[model samples]
Target chain A: MYDAGKIISGIIIFFILVSFPIWISAASGTIGDVPELNLPADEEQCVEDAEWMRANHMDLLIDWRETVVREGVRVYTASDGKEYNMSLTDTCLDCHSPKAEFCDQCHDYVAAVPNCWSCHVDPGGS
Target chain B: MNALYAFFAVALLMLVAFFGVWGLGWNTLFAVMIPYAALAIFIIGLIYRVVKWARAPVPFHIPTTCGQQKSLPWIKSDRIESPSSTMGVVARMAMEILLFRSLFRNDKVQLEDKKRVTFQGNRVLWLGGLVFHWSLLIILFRHSRLFMQPVPDFMIFVRDIDGILQGLIPAVFITDIAILMALTYLFLRRVVFPQVRYISLPSDYFALFLLLGVVILGVLVKTAWKVDIEGVKVLAMGMFTFNPVVPEGIGPAFYIHIFLASVLLAYFPFSKLMHGPGIFLSPTRNLINNSRAVRHINPWDYPVKVHTYEEWEDEFREAIRGVGLPLEKE
Candidate 1:
């Protein structure tokens, strides 16, 4: 009797705004499927474990870049005593050569625009 | 004092962020997991709080009236102040929310040297509240750039207007300075005003200190430290997409800034900061002053046994006759 219609409509609007993420995801047709990453076929093993790499690869890459570019420390000794050059172009691309297949797969899926390609030349790109 | 404890709590939070990221090397946990968890908790907690409030039934017309109500056609009604219609109520709420109308009318009472009490308008609190809220809104709107890809034109327009003073190397946002100044004023008001200080709780100070810490860290990141802006954007996008990645070259300072913000989000529903949404649910502000126009009945009112006047007269008929009191039944 006391404008229950207004209150009901207000509640409806509130729910719509609150559940926006769910509805947006539903509309976009990307609710549950995780981004499919393309693994390198040539290498059987990486410098680190798959789980560790998935989480901390960006951090490790940053450390490598800072050490190599700023401090002029090129040689990186892995925990397993494997010595590797701290060069993204030479070392990383040597294994994961095709940037589109390897990097862009996940990046595009997530809409993450990393600045790495801005300065560094993609080995896969013409 | 409670304020001291609150200050320490915020300090401890900052230390946790610093140590968690730098010392423990929990970059991924702080960067990805904590943000996701905080956001989930915030959404769930907010929904729960709002739903609980909505379910609550206000059985009475308890709108706080500050002016004349709607009456005889000749009598004028203060529609904006004592609203009696839906449109009037909307206008009232708009003024309250947008301009802080009630706060603007706040009065402070103080005893003068000659034992005379004087009431004066306290505009400082109103100004601080207005500035702080507006700046916070602007800052949040600007942050949309981090979450959205090819950020919306309107958000870009807001950013441009906020950073209109563009002579500096990194153009300074007006909201950045305004929020800090307003927060400081609010903090000092609690300290300097004896009446406010007496009523202040640890939670009150905690909210202010936490907000201050967040704003200060944000200012530091924007001005002092040069962080990877693109990397931060990448991280924001990842969080939204449920494919979180700790971006490269994002410095420890950025981690601390975000960690503090995450804490604020997680603490929001439980704290007085919930006033943002709670204000809308408030019966005193949102209800219309239409008690005279319409009779309000409590929906949950239950039937109760009652002794009617006839029944009372039947029971006390002899006593009433002795006292020479006439009854309707007799």
Candidate 2:
């Protein structure tokens, strides 16, 4: 009975939880790309390939110890190439520049405080 | 006392940080120094966590596999859910990372007669998270026009798409609603769910509140109180090129918004919010499940003298003969 009740409650929450994605997909389906149907099998690169990636993408490597950080979760690759970890960079700033007409107009329209300009930047620095 | 004291201290700091913008006239620090500090904290904290995890020894090939392992050809295997090969693992990771597939699979229990398994999608959290992220991205895109020497076309395209509604005064953008709803949902979920609430801390609420405060203040500065946007562009351009100087005719609310944003950035890496990057480093999600077919030798693995089967058999050959067991050779 208890398990059953838990299931019911879980189901309700699940539906509520699902509503967000469904709604988002329905609304903003046009933006971004997600390859869901035809997925690859191997997630990790072979040892040789990993080595090649390291050699080619040296800029990706940084000193973890001296680097600034945020959370309890860890992602570190050893200098010896024995350990490899990856995390997505925070790409929030690239779009929200203060000089851009797109951000200022709309952010202004809604009477919102725009923070895109605080740091030093040009309007379009391609 | 430590916990209570921490909460009040945080409250005090937030208040001070806010007042420094409104009252203390510390515009330079509010606009610049604080953001750098937060960014530093985020980077340092993130590295600290990752290094710590990297140091934890995982000798075994333990991946939370859901598909078929590479085994005897006669046996059928589930490939996508439980990946035995590297390609399968990649696909699995793609699904897990890009789409919250695992969270999507989360089942809710139902009770009436028999135990019911309702197949309602459980991706709302993921979607809200996505909305917040994507909307934030677009907002950033729109902002690029202000700082760039020559505005990018893509920025213009994205801005048009976001502000497609352009219905009322100043052209209403979609991000306003998206961010608002996303933030509300995340915040409400924390308060509503007992399980989530149990783990909820003041910092979590503070992050949401702080973001909300920035958004609100932004709206105020933009529509409610229009500021010199050209001046803002000059100020921002100067900041990016490392030649920051106060722009003339910029409003105080702009400073407030800038200060709060700086706070968000600096606070980003140290808070639980840093999970944005931590997900990729997760061993459970990233590690391949090829243990049965392949040996995963640890780089830090120490040397061990292992006895071979033939060596053991060599010693037991005489004993086997005594027991009348067939010998391969003789």
Candidate 3:
């Protein structure tokens, strides 16, 4: 059998579930103390500084000479945890030092006009 | 129990937040402090895990390889099965991790009509896993669009290519569909198959449930609700720079999505999900096959002074005479 009744009930539940975001958005202002995302619809959203990212503070730097048995080169990908070292030169930002050299070169290769380097650094090897 | 625990933890947090907001009207605490706290936990937890993993020193060269040993030409051998060369090992690891080649050919056995039967070509996991990982990679790539300022050309190109359909509103992307299907396949496979379910635990189920939750909620907020996309981007950008501000017009649903994502981040390095980084760190994967070329003395083995045979003979000379045994140089 098609089971129209069961399917219909499911559809009804689905709509209510789907409407959750709408409900929350609508309730933003009404519910006392709810943080209203009632952003002025006209507010031209400006690209703000990447505020969420906190600088990694740990001295994760590896002593290259000792670990990798090299004079200076140290950082290996974490996969070589035992025998390898992590160095700053391997940081993602080193090559993509500037947008033109590091970020834009490859991004432009694929034809991407990046805004990331404007605000954030490259995936510099940590 | 894992699902139940995860669900209850989520529900409890929601209820606490709801009440806190309603009762105290602590907008700043809810909107600002909690996110900062979560981010702190996330960073600390991630660092702790990485540091712990790094600090663990592997004392031996134990790279898991599959290829021919660099032995004598007369010593006939299968190269890929037991690799003893760098090139051979690299090829094997690459195939195993990137393509999941071994898993694709992996077999599962089950009883059929009282016969020990092996099912061949059972690649649901390998295929599902490949889809999930590949799709996730593309999705993460696509998300880079938000963090950029002028927006890089390649990202724009990818954006355009992803929306090549050119017909859907909000520009439906290939990765979105692919990730959805991938996660669905993974989840369904776990639930539908008896063999899989038999070995499945709450953690496995939780991984699927959590991913599904994120995907479902993401689709809900993105597609149907007509969310303020610009507002979300502002919040994301602001957060990335450490000036974490709750942008206006961003819905609570966004918080739930972001919150769940943050939870996943905090859980990542600790969870088996960390196998991404863990796989590479594994001594079995990174160690070079140099046993034949170089002697691997276990660095920790203490050297003990050996007693010479002359010293032993001297001590046992009297005992030997008592037993009428022959003596040397006597």
Candidate 4:
């Protein structure tokens, strides 16, 4: 308390900066309703398990791209004993079409910018 | 031996968190309660320590000056090195904090064969410290995506720039690699150099090992185990928003990472890590070198009762005249 004013001001600044996440969340609005993805109504099962797909979808997609473009192997075998064409636009986006509803929700929520859209176009409508 | 002790301490912590979550299934305790407790402790302890330091009166102008001070009108002064005014002090502090100006002037003295000695410029510590801190700042900023409701654009920009390599699956951040490399250099510098090794304590090794464990666990969870990031974010956001919920499918590595981070926060105020704030309060660096121009009265100085020469003469005047010593006072 010897230099009360300066010390108090410094502590205040440190407090505000360290608790920035809380202040930012309060200012932005609610606790943020978890992003709701519109699952495809027609399909009950995806190429892989939901948990696996949630985490490793990028790896799967990248593998498909490499296999199809470089190795010219056009078929993929899912772990559940199912075969499908190794194509992003044809097979993956075919089911999860109109990327905004399916892809953008979670991607935007996590602020992940997967460069999948750079080469492949999003099928406009389901 | 000290390094081994520190390493085992961190290993024990990692195992505790691992078992606390994976074995006993106390996800809520490891995830929510401990983190909240650690954050509260961090905030309160930091304020208390800083206030305690603030109460200690600096009774002297003790800035350690290395360059020419402000004196006569004709002589040029090194304003930043030997700061005499508030503006000069501010500029000097800025340079110290941002660029580590003093550390940049480090010199290493080495005995050349058996008798001769040589001095060489040594900037490795400064470079390592700067890289580590800057990368840590960037990583912390990037983590806002998990806690913030609507992630800011600038944070995303920083993440994108760090994750620029397109070939990797879960994009690799440059800061992740940079921080690990910088930490290795710092740790090795402490261990390999005989002089530094003599001065290094177990607490120093403990902090370094703890951070290493946290970062390595994070990288493993992200790339190898590939935990559900959405679930991780849910947990992070829940803690920040005060609506704590233990999310499912998050791996044990993630839990260990969070727990170690909490321990670090709780330990910060009591450890050398407090240097983060202590640097600002150091009298040697923060005080201005203006004792000549400005009188710095000690805060503890108090008035004293003293008998003056006139008063002493008046008290003993009659006694002196009676003894025929002096008869000036009629």
Model number with the top DockQ:
4
Off by over 4 Å in 4: B108-121, B166-170, B303-330
lDDT of 3 at B154: 64
TM-score computed on alpha carbons, candidate 3 = 0.59
Candidate 4 TM-score, true structure as reference: 0.89
Give Cα distance to truth, residue B229, candidate 3, Å: 1.9
- Residues B1-330 of candidate 3 have per-residue lDDT tens digits of 444665566565555554555555554565556666666665566556655666555667676555555578898654554566666666666876799766776866666787867566467678778988877766665665544443445656767777666333443567778778988887667667777767777777666666766666566665544345444554544554556455554445555555556566566656778676556456665555667687665545677999977888899989988899888857
Count of backbone clashes, every candidate in sequence: 0, 69, 52, 0
Model 2's CAPRI class is: incorrect
- lDDT by residue (B1-330, candidate 1, tens digit) is 989999999999999989998898899999988888898888778767776776667778789998898887789999979997989889999999999999988876779899998866477889999999999989987776666544446777788788876423233689999999999999998998999999999999999999999999898876666465545665666676777767665567888899999999999988788898778777888878988778877767788999989889999999998899987867
Per-model TM against the reference = 0.72, 0.59, 0.59, 0.89
Off by over 4 Å in 2: A1-126, B1-14, B40-58, B70-80, B84-87, B108-122, B168-171, B303-330
The candidate maximizing TM-score is: 4
Arranged by lDDT, best first:
4, 1, 2, 3
Clashes of 4: 0
Compare candidates 3 and 4 on lDDT and give the better one: 4
Give each prediction's root-mean-square deviation over alpha carbons: 9.3, 22.8, 22.4, 4.7
lDDT of each: 0.79, 0.59, 0.55, 0.85
**Each prediction's DockQ?**
0.05, 0.01, 0.02, 0.59
Give the per-residue lDDT of model 4 (tens digit) for B228-295: 88877877888776787677777898899999999999999888898989888877887778888788
Whole-model alpha-carbon lDDT for candidate 2: 0.59
Candidate with the greatest lDDT versus the true structure = 4
lDDT (tens digit, per residue) of candidate 2 on A1-126 = 012343345345634442333343335442122112211244444322443322222223222312434343345544557553432222212332333444444333222333324543544533
